[model samples]
Target chain A: MAAANENITADAIEATEFMELSRKYRVTGVPKTIVNETIEIMGGLPEKMFVRQALEMPEE
Target chain B: MGLLSPQDEATLKNHLSGITIPVQLVLFTQAFGGSESGDVAKQILNEVASLNDKITVVEKNFVLDTEDKAKYKIDKAPAIVILSDGTDTRMRMYGAPTGYEFVGLVEAIIVAGTAVIDLDPETMKWLQAVDKPTHIQVFSTPT
Candidate 1:
């Protein structure tokens, strides 16, 4: 998503390495995605479904 | 002794052969009072770069390179900023790129080098239509 748009910046963070961030976001599991610090995705989902949830798009 | 075995190198080299443009991996690491993973990150990046001629690793001091740190908005050590032909891709990886993180790094490099995002057409449309600033942070363990 970051590659497709100039306004998007994506960061892949190590949960164990960055304990503070993980704690701040309450990440107890792997593959936790936080978008704009507002939307939280707990685990991996299908590509289209993940993108939809991440973008907050209405489901069709 | 390198972390990647000879066979692994060969496989990675073959995978990286698809890149047509230069891919620069700008790595920031602190020299003192930093985690050992920083050194590991550097070594991993060097090994990855050694496989592909078009890929180069540029090292930066996390403490000393204040300008670059601010420019990339990097707030931590061992952060990797991916650049495609000298242009920022806005893709970053924090901590050591090992295990599954390595795969993600490779994918990001491919996207940056080729300017091709491997997403569904509809997904691409949604991403391209994004108008506001979006900051995405994905957290995962190395294992």
Candidate 2:
């Protein structure tokens, strides 16, 4: 996503390496995604679903 | 010891063969008071760099290289900032790129080097429509 758009930045953070961040974000599970510091995705979704949620688009 | 097997190297090399643009991996690591994973990350990046001539790994001091640390906005001990043709891809990886993380690292590198996004056309449109600053942080474990 970040590569596709200059306004977007993506960080793949290791939960175990940064326990403080993991705890701050309440990342109890793996593959937790935080977008714009507001949207929280719990697990991996399909490509379209993940993109929709990450971009906060309205469901069709 | 190399983590990737001989077969893996050949396969990865083939995967990276289409890279036309140069990809630079800037790795920030602290020498002291840092976890062993920093060393592990370094090793993994080095191994990956060895596979493709178009790929280069640049190491930086996490504490001493304050300017670069701020430039990349790296807050962790070991972080990788991917660059395509010396331009920031806005892609970062924290911790050692092993296990599933290794696969993600390779994918990101491909994106940086090949300028190819495997997303659907509609998905690409959505991504291109993004105008506001979107910060995406994905947290995952090695396993």
Candidate 3:
């Protein structure tokens, strides 16, 4: 997604390495994604579903 | 000792053969008060760079290179910023790129090296339509 848009910046952080960040974001499990510090994805979803939720798009 | 086996090197070379543009991996690692994963990340990046002529690793000191750290907006000890032909890809990886993260690093490299994004067309459309700044942080464990 970051590659697709210049205004987007994506960071892949290791939960164990960044303990403070993990705790701050309430990352209780692996593969948790936080978008814009608000949208939280608990687990890995399908590609389209993940993208939609990350972008806050309405489901079709 | 190198991390990749001989067969793995050959396979990786073939996989990276399609790269036409140069991909620069700007890695930041703190020499002091940093985790051992910093060294591990460096080793993994070096092994990956060895596989493709178009790939290069540019190391930076996380403590000393203040300007670079700010430029890349890297607040952590170890981070990787992928650039495609001198352009920022806005893709970053924190921590050691081992285990499943290694696969992601390879995929990001391919995207950077080829200037291609293999997203679905619909997803691409949605992404391209994004007019505001979007910050995405994905957290994962090594296992």
Model 2 ranges off by over 4 Å: none
User: What C-alpha lDDT do the candidate models reach, one value each?
Assistant: 0.94, 0.94, 0.93
lDDT of 1 by residue, B64-129 (tens): 999999999999988999999999999999999999999999999998888888889988988999
Would you list the rank order by DockQ, best first?
1, 2, 3
Q: Least accurate stretch of 10 residues (summed lDDT) in model 3 chain A? A: A1-10
- For model 3, the superposed segments whose C-alpha errors exceed 4 Å read none
Regions of candidate 1 where Cα sits further than 4 Å from its true position? none
DockQ for every model comes to 0.94, 0.93, 0.91
Better of 1 and 3 by lDDT: 1
Q: Number of backbone collisions per candidate, in order?
A: 0, 0, 0
Span of ten consecutive residues with least summed lDDT in model 2 chain A: A14-23
lDDT of 2 by residue, B2-112 (tens): 988999999999999999999999999999998999899999999999999999999999999999999888888799999999999999999998888999999999999
* TM-score on alpha carbons, each prediction: 0.99, 0.98, 0.98
lDDT by residue for model 3 (B1-143), tens: 79889998899889899999999999999899999999999999999998888999999999999999999899997999999998999999999988878888999999999878999999999999999999999999888
